[model samples]
Target: MSLRAYLHAIARCPSLEQLWETHTQRMAEYGFDRLIYGFTRYRTSTSLGDPEDFVILTNHSREYTDEFLHGGLYFHAPMVHWALAHDGACSWAVLHDMTRERAMTPEEERVVEFNRRMGVHAGYTVSFKSISNRSKGAIALTAKPGMSQGQVDAVWAEHGSDIQLMNEIAHLKILTLPYSTPSRALTPRQREALEWVGDGKTMQDIAVLMGLTSATVEKHLRLARDALAVETTAQAVLKASFANQMFVMDV
Candidate 1:
């Protein structure tokens, strides 16, 4: 597809699943068969916040992600560190230079070795621009196995501008979509109860609006807090709002 057509499609994507599906397919055309996109709104000086609160989308194999993400390898990844510190695209050649100079710490070197074992040899990482100091988003584009950094660079030279534009648009569109962790999605009832609470409704008021007993309404609010991993209903409302999961129109 032409760049213009792709950008239009991305802008019109109503759901995160559709956007991620099209994006992974589009990126694979450029020999980047594996992609991991991560965004966090709760970043702190010492951490990226809880992994459960992050928006993580990827097309990489389960084995790769299980280790890289679930095993805590991402914390020490060289490219991940680069993305945390800067914005815009970066070639993996810098990682190679670091390896040659023996500049990587032991933890970083271990991450590189794991990537090599997994055939994630060459790629690019795009760190998206953020207006808030506590927000960061980035995508790692891993070249197909056996492709060299030189070859990926050549492709970038010809089409990098369009690729970067598409990624940026995808990131922005994703932010507008309602997202909850796989195990933490609120039911329609739970969401409705939270919406009422957010509007400063009392339990009896929400019960009247939802046509449920006050006990049921309170139960829903409690479940919403549990789903969002917040201690209070107010915190649940805030977290849901941050995830775009509150007061969202049906898609």
Candidate 2:
């Protein structure tokens, strides 16, 4: 597909799943068979916030992500560090250079070794620009197995600009879609209660609007807080709003 057509499709994606499906397929055409995109708004000076709060989408097999992500290997990943510090495309050759120079820390070396075992040797990492100091987003495009970094670099030299642009567009569209980890997800009733609270409604008022007793209204708000892992209803509203999960049209 043409670049223009791909961008248009992503811009109109009604849900995250559809957008991700379209993006992964398009990227595979460029020889990047595995893609992992991650975004976090809860970044701190020392950390990228909690893993549960991140927006992570990947086409990699569970065998890879299960350890890289769930096992916290991403924290020690060299490209992840580079992505956090830079705002553009970088070749994995940089990591190779670092290895040659013995500049990688022990933890980082372990991550590199792990990737090598996973057949994740060749790829490019694109670190997306962030407007907020506490937010970061990036995508890693891994080439098909047995493809050397030199071969991947050759493809990048020819079409790097178009590839980066498509990824940036896909990342922007992803941010507009509502996303919540399963544990953070709210039920329809919980969301409606929070929406009312956002509008400054009292418990009784929300109860009347939701056709429930004040006790049930309070119950929904309490459950919302638990789901969002917030201490109060106001915090839940803010968290949900940040994730674009509040007052959103059903998709």
Tell me the spans in candidate 2 whose CA falls farther than 4 Å from its real position.
Answer: none
Q: Give the per-residue lDDT of model 1 (tens digit) for 115-157.
A: 9999998999999999998999999999998899999999999
Q: How accurate is candidate 1 locally (lDDT)?
A: 0.93
| Clashing residue pair totals per candidate (backbone < 3 A) | 0, 0
lDDT (Cα atoms) of all candidates against the true structure: 0.93, 0.95
Candidate 1: minimum summed lDDT over ten consecutive residues — where?
A: 242-251
Q: What pairs collide in candidate 1?
A: none
- What global local distance difference test value does model 2 have? 0.95
